[model samples]
Target chain A: MRLAAIALFALAIISALGACSKPPASERFLQDPQALKRGKGLFIGTCGAYCHSTRKDNRDAPYLFDCEWRHGGSDTEIFNTISTGVSNTRMVGFAGKLPDGEDDIWKIVAFLRASREPCG
Target chain B: MEATVETAVDMGSELALPEIPTHWTNARPIGHSRGPVADADLRAGPSAGQWLLYGGNYENYRLSPLETLNPATAPTLQVAWAFPTGTSGQFEVSPVVYDGIMYASSSYNRLFALDARTGELYWRYDHALPGDLRLCCGPMNRGVGIHGDTVLMATLDAHLLALNRLSGEILWDAEIADYQAGFSATSAPFILKNMAIIGIAGGEYGVRGFFDAYDVATGKRLWRHYTVPAAGEPGVETWAGTSYENSGAPAWTSGAYDAESDTLFWTTGNPSPDWNGDDRAGDNLYSNSLLALDPQTGERKWHFQFTPHDVWDYDGNTQVFLVDIEHEGQPVKAIVQANRNGFFYILDRNTGAFLRATPYVEQLNWASIDATGRPVVNPSAVPLEEPEFRVCPGNMGGMNGAWSGALDPELGLAFIPAIESCQHLQKGISVYADGQPFLGGTPLITDAEEDTAYGHISAIDVATGEVRWRYRDHDPLGAGTLAAVGGIVISGTQDGHAIALNSATGELLWKFRVGGGVRSQPIAFELDGTAYVAIGAGNWTSMAAYQGGTTNIPEGGNLFVFKLPAGS
Candidate 1:
């Protein structure tokens, strides 16, 4: 009975975890092979290697690879941050300047998040 | 206090002379202004007792031919007077004297003509910038250019105005460039013939640099030469693809005019994004290079690249000196520069042939210059997108183009205010955002360990690559050098000390604490037979000051003029 109860508890926790876990926008592009490739190309063409350097020392702007953030790091937050830009910083508003507009910023953010992932 | 006028004929319009006055009302023989100084006339011939040339002469030599302030009596120097600029900011403007009146520009684009002896203001002109003005550096005007009846002042917003020297009224104003797009002017407008030649600043904001000449009398835009070549132009291949659009090769200081060669030898700044070159590939010709151009047509006669494809911020914007030197046992017209890349370079001024390159500082580690004058950059020092690298003679440590440098002909020595320091650089792709600076990488720290950072007045012999003498300081040298006729090298320390050294040996002779740091060049002139040394003691420019870690450099702009006590 105790073993059955333990099993039931484990099943209940697993169910709750499954219900709570919702894959982020960053995860979608980061995990999907086609999406990641397109995002990498878009990021490199538009924002990669610029002031938000992939390199550690040369970054005049904040690094985007990791989860650390000056504004926020959530998927919705990162998207809004990139599209709107932070005040008094070089992180310019790329809402319209990019060829793909806001979509490009999301793609670049996804590529940057991939750098923090295991495969990245 | 306020700027006071002891005596004057109102403004430039009410003045007695159409050009510079021949004499002061108090009757001190004004000898510097005898004739109209043309572009090619490097030695416009100082006949008046007033300070005339920007470098005391057109060659930017900073040498005073006036011998009254001899070293024997230099110790007895006493303050004649001090003219205080009303604001608190950089004072790098070297005063130009005509008759007994002195004309100078202060920080924030303020111009004043004062009594040379009494510190009384004659007239003042203010070129006010817009409130939202974006500038890479502080607004420091390097004095004015005067020719015929007009005084040319280059505004920080990149406008050239011809003002009536007698009344200080604007005769005409010509727009040089749109300042909001990172184009501005701080270097003094150079007057040659009837044209005012000027080079624009703001490489950090990614504007294509150029050499411009305006009509001195009417302020008409004459000829302009873009330093960064466009598509199909001579040096375009050096820049990869469309990167040339934002590639930088700015000129922050005035060039030395070779009257004989009819060439304007100007130096260019580093390319943008400063440290990262993935976008702008190849050697990036003309960035960190010196070009000898025709003043008449703005045509490039010859060019010499100092630090090609520079990942380091070694700007070639420093002044180049034209000197007649013995190269290979022949008297050759050589152009010598105490390069910002920590090397002293001598080039054949006529053909831009590399003559010699020698390290003036002890901290150079990036690359040794080759016989062809190209830098053999260390593979490790090339800032890539990965690991970082340490570099010596970090940007601000080598030499300052804004303060300028001087060459002593008699001593054959170039007094370069250099620093002993290093920095760390990490290179990556930095994009060019409009209305923002184009520093490709992060703005690397130019000064890392201040304890290891000492300054020097590195006196390099231009004729031969020799360290003739060096005067070390606890901090970097603040001001430019003056190769005085009294066999003295007058320079200043960042800690407010104006010092005179034996130019032959760098032996300290006289020193005085002016209470404010001196970042402008020391100037000497005579009244009757008496000699006086004058300099501005408010140095609020420098990266060190801007960083807020430097010493308490006294505020207030005061032009301190000193003369030896009567009969010593």
Candidate 2:
């Protein structure tokens, strides 16, 4: 009986760890304040202010907050689109090229999502 | 003769009474009845008149009636006035001019009314767009439609808006498609009779494409026809599964209207999950096909599939030209298209029967013709679950970019701007989860240069389906073809020049430097027996991502209206 009880405890712990690894429904990784702050810094450094800045005359590329993803929405979808890139469009993939790889793309996506979210 | 004098006096009084420069410009209805002589014989040539319709006319001919300007003398044509758009977005629209006024739409849904003769702004209307509307294509408005006293326009957020021509007031507005599934409107609306027809854009963004018709006066939805077949539709069997419901078959360009036959001829884009045909198979009905529909009832008359189960994104969204041509000694009503898949198709407009299909460009590898007009696509050419496959025409194709061809009535030729290039495309399987699909592809680009014969303006005989003549350009021909009255075939090139060529022989007539590349179609208009040609010049190219280079052209957006000095 004790052995079975220990086995059940182990299984529950493993399942709990798995659940923790996945992002919660309420807590979007993209809306995390730290991730957005880091993302904004990286975006400014890499993409440069010419395209990422919010300006009236800057019609070439949309502002980071206002960038219309031709693909889909959601943090994961935006992250994947930014990482994988689109063909025949201006969005080029940064999969292996970005400094921090997938994590960096996720950060950028988080920053964009946070920026677009209405603040109280 | 008495009637002509009275008409002239009426026209003069009409022009004199309209001191409201802007109101006079936008108020000119679709088919302006009274104006300076617009006939081919009465003017210097057909290049001497104003462009009044979406594709210049309901026929989608892109031909003008005034002809005073020739390419040989284009350098001598003086600029009367220039109206700067002053906005920063790419303007992909062809301005509609009637009487002495011009109507145009900008990228971000800004419509402007300007004086055609003096380049003065009359009125501006802004359709307030939602914040989160994602645009698959760029924020581009193709053009606008004018019917009766109302000017019609389709917005990027999938709304059809009607404005009072004289007052720029929103008469009626109707939302055609939802923005959540990535559906939007970029193509210009076509006005026929009292019905306004429009097609949805968003094939790349994975939206089920459709075309809708609305009542011109009241914004009542008349009919909605799905480009992809639904469950019980005739072509539902082709999809073979539920995948058909989510298929992508956008009609991103304006359709041609045959007033005589009362048929609307339009083309559709490729099916979605763009690169892979795994889920949706069996010739994916209605997508990448030319459809002829009854404009009033929205019923399909006939359809001709160009690229069945299209995997290379070769959309049949080119302008469908309705022409009356003699095929094998019989007077046949036909529709001509310079398909994006590198083929020229001539179909019987009355029926969707294929008359002839010939390759208009050089590098085409997807399929070849047998005894019949059907394209036997090589199974190996189909994009597989791998990384790199060499594909001809790439995504651009021989006649890629945006161009509208002109059909010369007298010469029986269809003037086209064609590119000669190939691409290496790689496709991989992807899942459609969270509205995004995984696409893995690489393109090996070559052969696009100034010295190489990469692009040309060719005139093809519509009846014989043969290349009559071609004029090579240093850069790709970006603008559309315009056949004018004085035997002049006018076209714009990426090298920033508005060129006039002989419609019969493709001889260079005149060339005028427009300061920037002329990607928009050129229009010719006449006022008081004097002829003028107008073209919008700006340094913008849709294929900017494929080719990386600094644009040498000036970065200014302006409408240049040119005319011969006084009495010449």
* Highest DockQ model number: 2
Model 2 ranges off by over 4 Å: A1-120, B1-50, B71-75, B384-389, B433-453, B539-542, B547-556
Candidate 1 — which residues are off by over 4 angstroms? A1-120, B1-42, B45-48, B384-388, B446-450, B545-549
**Residues B1-568, candidate 2, lDDT per residue (tens digit)?**
0010101223456456533222122343433444332222211222344565768777777777655555544546777887776554345667776556677876667787776777767777756666556564356676787766677899888899998765576799899877645678877787776778899977765577899889888989999888988788888888857878778888878887776787888789878756667777788889988888888798999999988887777888888888889987899988888888888888889888788888877677888865556678866666643324456665666675366788877788889887665554444333333233222222333343222436788888887668888898756566777777567887776666777788888888777777666666777778777777777766453343232212455555666777877764
TM-score versus the correct structure, for each prediction: 0.80, 0.76
TM-score of chain B as predicted in candidate 1: 0.91
Which digits, one per residue and each the tens of the lDDT, describe model 1 over residues B106-218? Answer: 88788887777777766677675665454555667788888875778888788887776665667898989987687888888876778788889878777898879888777
Candidate 2's displacement at residue B39, Å, is 19
B399: Cα error in model 2, Å: 2.0
